[model samples]
Target chain A: MSLADLHFFKMTREPSLDALCAVVAERHAQGLATILYAGGTDWMVEQEMRAPLHDEPPLVVDIGRMGELRGISLAGDSLRIGAGTTYLELERSAVVQARAPMLVRMAKDVGAVQIQARGTLGGNLATASPAADGVAALAAYDATIVVKSARGERRIAMADLQTGYKKSTRAADEIIVAVELAPPPEGSPWYWRKVGARRAQAISKVALAGVAVVENGTATRFGVGMVSVAPVTARMATTRALVLGKALAEITAEEIDHAVDQDVTPIDDVRSTGEYRSHVARALTRDLLRQLGARV
Target chain B: MKISLTLNGAPRELDSAPLVRLLDALRGPLGLTGTKEGCGEGECGSCTVLLDGDPVNACLVPIGQCEGRAITTVEGLGEMAHLSPLQRCFIDEGGAQCGICTPGMLISAEALLRRVPDPDEPTIREALAGNLCRCTGYQRIVESVRRAAELLREGAAR
Candidate 1:
């Protein structure tokens, strides 16, 4: 069949990972390549419409109906959010707001309300865009991703998931079912900031999300995500150390800037210049530190 | 795939791809032409529809997922014989200019009224944020929602 012969598919209710895998296997056995469709926001539609498809018609496996992949729950000290849950759902979730306000804030900044209502968390991670808002937030919390396939499930640290720009370690048969994050210890101040060309609906040039535990004028654990800097989102080790032992007020602007610059490897793109991204990353890091200091 | 659903209080079915967007299915298969396709993507809410009473961008929703769900399109809101209160308010208050964004605007307003019988300006703005109106600068759209809310309230009192 030609590309034009291909069409859209829908699965109203959530389906199991096994069901999805079985469907994919069936399509593959039929000698047709299958593309997984979830939310269909950015990747699938654009590629299908723009790219040349001279090969066999690609079958779409709609996994949006998988109910098992929706919801946010507290499992002991960790928080588990189902991959199917939309950004809007996370923004409105009281439990997420109370425990991880930074995540809630990130969800609100993703896209317009319409996009937020439909874009799934799994889609965000699977897209693996360097500028993805949720990925930066997940990185800050040192979150763990749960990937499930027909064989079983495996948990990988968030840092290990994104191997490169728009790349992930997920196997062809595995689907990310959920993300688990350890709750921040009490009294820790968490801060997230995203700087884009426009306030809403625009993708980020450089986004930063940081979680710091400051106790009695000393930083305990500091985690940050420098988005759109490298091929994948990453934590800056040097910056983490600078903020870890010193008080937020004690960190100098020069020290913060140096650490941030050391952490990121941004490239010049249509959205921003590499130098500009580096400059903003430094400025944002300083601003977040100052904000945390003021709050304390 | 053969999918069936109750659209705007009417039972309907169509033979289409399960992955086909509900937006395309509504316009192509079912021939409900009132719904406009603005972005073709979900960003623009011109293709908004009520799925199980909640407003969603039809472009992003797969037709197969809509099985057994009650969907309310712009045509379902009212008829030529009798317009829904929200539609009447939009007509009287000049909510529509070019009319491309009307269906989506009405569906969004309907959702807001269903949730909050009387929504404030901010609430109305938040509800309609997903919708983009190039002709009318949104002042009139917000006013129309306010008017619709009052009409619903008055109807409730009666």
Candidate 2:
């Protein structure tokens, strides 16, 4: 099959995880890669248009009908978000707004309202783009990705699952079922910021989500995600330590500056320069830290 | 796949690929050409339609997914002979210039009014965020929605 023979499959309703996994496994066994279709924003137009299938067109499996992979629920101390839930749903979801406001902020910045109305969180994770807004927020919250295949189900840390730039550990036969995030630590100040060329619909040059838990004038557990600056979105260990062990006021400017340099290893890309990204990361870290301090 | 939908108060059936966009199915198969395809992508809501009362980009929605759903296209809202309140307001308020974006603008406005009958400026702006009007700069379009709301309110009062 060639691009001319490319076919589209549409489901009446969202497909069950088992059904989706079966389809993937069947296609893989046939030596055919299945292009998981959701939202149809990035997939239907951009990628397919840019690179037409030369041999057998990948089987397009539509998962939009999978009702099981939709909705947000709070389970114990964690919040589980179905992979198929759109950004618009996340933004409007009361549970997400209350428990994970930063994720809501990330959803709002995913794309224009039209894109948000269709783009799903699972799509973002599956694409594994370094500049993905949801990835940054998920990293800050220590999110866990739930993968389901015909064999069974397994959970992987968001950081570990996202191995490299535009790459993930998700098996072809596994469909991302949901993402579970531990609730924000008590009394912790949360802040998220995205630096893009324009406000709406623009991809980020650098994005960051920071969570600071301050107790007795000292930081406890601090987490941050430096998006679009590395091979994959990651947390900064040195910066986390700097903010965690010491009071914001006592943390010297040099220490903060050094942490920023140590934490981020950016690359020169079309969106921004590595030096500029490093500079902004440092400035944003200090500003966010100060903002968190004021909140407490 | 054969998909059936109640479009604009009328029932219609289409034979198309399951992945065929609702915009294409409507325009090509069913011949409801009111909905324009500006971007083909969802970025431009030129193909906005009411999918089960919520306004969505028709281009992004596959035809198969809309099975047994109530779809309101621009043609269903009003016609040359009988205009809906929104269609009337758009004309009276000069909401359309080139008129290419008018159909989508009307459907989006209708969807908003169905949810919030009496909406303020911010609400109006946010509701119509998906629909883009390049000619009028949206000031007149916003005015048209307000006018339609007044008409709706007056009709209810009477």
Candidate 3:
């Protein structure tokens, strides 16, 4: 059968967040599968492969238009990014560009205009791909993933969101609603790089995202997130500790490599091998320090 | 699903499946074959169409999501007899080589020209980044877009 035959899944559209929850709740109570359909950039690829559907054809709930799951706003000191906000919206939002340029940078690298025009920041987090640029960039900001269902709401830490490859802490009944994080500290260096097979459209083989608040040539607070080098998206706490209180220039490349080795558990996959990912992970650390623009 | 969308300049309705790819919906039931499909996946822009004024891969867009939206495909760019300046440039500049990528290229170019008339090489290149052409190198494609931008600007001035 052709790919067109793969379009056999049943779908339903929910008008509001409450309506979405009602549908999800009903599906959950029935123990049936419900796929939250947002930007279908990823889902359509799966359909092309004719991947096996759940026992019963799953209900593809169209929640791409619920207003509660859309928009980008600054809430007090944190940026509240609606889960349904498209990458194009993020790329163009004055609030996101001004408050979190790292996101803007990540947004530009996301699958060019076509994918970016539809892919969502929350969907990226929810997709739980190890090489998810959105998750990597948001992890660097120590963002919170807010998910809701008929039961209520839960805020999962970026570090705690993913449990395994294509796995997450999110329950079947829950859907990501928004992501909230404090923008990178003002005037601090924010860095994000996606090492892909090609410049655009290709998924990242490895990506590094780091934001540091250095004061007087010393690293005061920081977060470093890396992808395609772990079973799931990861933040480098060990590397963050290496120069937390020390001068940025004093931190050696070998020390960062050692810390990153402790943090990432990369393996040989179709996109890349463990060793190359480790090497780039170290190289990116050194690059981040070089970009700090701080000297003692 | 009874999907109602503004196609080209006309309002149309299709009794297509909600899960049907907009690309398949257009090509199969609706019978608009001008939008070619080089790859079933979203990788090739051969299936690019403007969804609500944004150029997106029609292969990845489901028909259900297109409710009450405007969709502009390659056929929507212009008629064959009276070609759009952008389509005419593709021919005169040799940008439409194998014809697989031209329709999508034209659609992407139309979106770009609408947003930024008289775009530079870099802007045009960036706008057409998603649409890939294998036969005629991107140089010719980019050049065609540059010329098309000039034509669009001239028409606007008039």
Candidate 4:
């Protein structure tokens, strides 16, 4: 019923990234179920902490000890964010806010200050929750999920990472190390919103993220993404095709609304009904695009 | 496993598994029951505590992750004999109702006043967003935090 059944708990603070990977791989090789211990264990306890054998607890490797996986930096064109960086850190980082303000706004909406102080972006990606605010923002930005194993390192696009609800392609021997975000072109207008049961600590019923760069009355770049409205956080291809490269005055509200209906496929769940999600997804898509249309 | 950390401004060491919730460690071995566990989950901020000066849910934090970090509980704020200004304000403003949410409310308010001594109503609400109160209806809690901020600012002036 509690963590008292835990048989093994190791704190990995090795300065070398390879050493941390080796430890995880070795643990996996021994046939023990392993979980990379980060600050976002609240959801893990509720969903994934069930032991294969009721008597024994899963192996939890405390990756928080590794100091190397803990910073925000800019490498060339993308922002290199360590997996251990908390949402609070993301909210306070000037560089991140400057580069991706929508991410900053979504980080603030993640949970209250308490949850934001501890939850990490890597955890959100690995959990593969369709309603996750951070994951939705990452999907909108087209971020890369950087993962490492004892063998080597690989990068997975955020859109291509999650395979299904509460599931991802992450291997047992691998760990999510960081997220790389290529900044949106300077001064691109972006909007993010989350519809929830209440103001704070409520899971999203439906969330939307939008970005557009309009110049000379024409949309040069535009992307609209939705969460909790599909199996995965996804871009509105139908919607983007209708508005991207089109003159602002030429796009009709009916086309925008229709695009939303075609692009997203939401199903009924505890938080919301499929009909409600579909209606809101259409309304939100139209509202955000209308706002972008005004800016042109 | 041996767990060691600074508890309520004192260096304390105890034997607890790394996976043990900090709430359990504080309420069990440490005998500091001031931190209440309303929802074993992190939703209710009844187990709020300051970890290295930042407010966090004690129920979600593993005892192992707190090693060497400064942990401040409700007791650290003040006690019966020497009540903290925030505690005094809570009493005067009638912020305590059923009493289950007071400790966490006080701890969260304490963290807010420490950061912004003259916070506005919206700012105070944002800071206390994590702490949920069903009894007080939150108006008095907000007033108590505002009064405590003034008290802290006046104390600094003297």
lDDT for each candidate structure:
0.81, 0.80, 0.85, 0.82
Q: Candidate 1 chain B, which ten residues in sequence have the lowest lDDT sum?
A: B36-45
Q: What are the per-residue Cα lDDT tens digits for candidate 3 across A28-80?
A: 89887788889988877876567555456778888888889998889789899
**What TM-score results for chain B in every one of the models?**
0.97, 0.97, 0.97, 0.98
User: Model 4 misses residue A145 by how many Å?
Assistant: 1.3
Estimate how well candidate 2 is docked, as a DockQ score.
0.44
DockQ of each: 0.47, 0.44, 0.76, 0.58
TM-scores for all candidates: the values are: 0.89, 0.88, 0.96, 0.94
Per-residue accuracy of model 1 over A187-242 as CA lDDT, tens digit each: 46888778887556668999889887777767776778878998898677788888
Estimate the overall C-alpha local distance difference test score of candidate 1: 0.81
Per-model C-alpha RMSD: 3.1, 3.1, 1.8, 2.2
Top-TM-score candidate index? 3
Docking class of 3: medium
2 versus 3: better lDDT goes to: 3
- In angstroms, the error of model 3 at A237 is 1.0
Best by DockQ: 3
Per residue, candidate 4 scores C-alpha lDDT tens digits across A1-296 of 44444324544345577887887788788886667778854543563255444544555667665676789998789898998888888988999888888888888887788888888887887788888788888777778888999989999887678888778887867788899987877778898989999877889999998767788877777766688998877677787788874787777778777888888889999999999999999888877877877322
CAPRI-wise, candidate 1 is: acceptable
Worst 10 residues of 1 chain A by lDDT: A1-10
**Single-chain TM-score of chain A, each candidate:** 0.90, 0.91, 0.94, 0.90
Please write out the lDDT profile of model 2 over residues A211-268, one tens digit for every residue: 6566777766677887887888868878887777767777776788898888788889
